[model samples]
Target: MDIELYHDSKYGNGARVAEEFKRLAETKGSNVNIHHVREAGSKNLPRADLYVFGSPTHFGKATRGIMRFVKKLELPPGTKYAVFGTFSGAAPDKKTGKMPSEEELEKRRRTIPMIDEALRSKEMAKVAEMRFFVKPENLKGPLEDGWQKIVEEFVVAILGK
Candidate 1:
């Protein structure tokens, strides 16, 4: 299958994950084209069997670049689509020493769904979705270790391998 994947990465975490996806998909016998969202422009993308988009979460949403790209995306009806996101999970309360509540978690998890919604708005069919949380190491992330395992799982799930 032909896969067209686009990503918006801040500090390179999202781009690294997208590259990993491309590598795994190619190993599974798929032709993949990966691009940064900014460079992709708002034109009609090349024909592909599957379309995948990913981005790092900034304030519980896909980065501005991704949102802008998705906003202008034009895709054929019923095109297979998937979404992924890298989030730096909820922060702890310094004073109370407590974790974020369920509601807060829900809010923080909205990035992928938001992207999925945008794709669906373009009449794309949703095939899969995933989220990978990165550890905040002064924003120089190594992707919280073992992130490749989840990437592999997502690739299998999305491609039916």
Candidate 2:
């Protein structure tokens, strides 16, 4: 399958994960292309059997650039797509030393739904979704431990292997 991963990264976390996804997809014998959202203009997106999107979670949603890209995206009806987000997990508040509540954590990981909605507007079929939490200490991350397994699972699911 021809796969394209278009991503926006802040602090490199999103790009890091996107690269891993690309590597994994390639290993599975699928032809995959990776593009930074800025580099892949909406008018010039390459043809692909599957479209993947990645972005760092910002203010509980995909970045404005990604949203705008999706809004202007031109894809055929029923195009297969997937979304991934690099999110910051809750850390203890400096003042109270308390972590965010479960609801807050869920809200903060809202990037997936927002991206999915945008893809849906283009009449795309979402095939997969993933959220890789970043380590809070450095802010920038090599994702949390066990990320390899997550990526592996995503590859399998997307490829239907």
| lDDT of every predicted structure (CA atoms) | 0.85, 0.85
Span of 10 residues, lowest total lDDT, candidate 2: 134-143
Task: Identify the runs in model 1 with alpha carbons over 4 angstroms from their true place.
Answer: 136-140
List the candidates' TM-scores in order. Answer: 0.93, 0.93
Pairs of residues clashing in candidate 2: none
lDDT of 1 at 19: 89
| Cα RMSD to the true fold for all candidates | 1.5, 1.3
lDDT of 2 by residue, 32-68 (tens): 8888888778876788999999888887888998888
Tens-digit lDDT track of model 1 for 24-143: 999999988999987898687898998889988777778889989988987777989889988875567668979889898778667888887787788889998888878753445768
Candidate 2 lDDT for residue 103: 90
Model 2 ranges with Cα > 4 A deviation: none
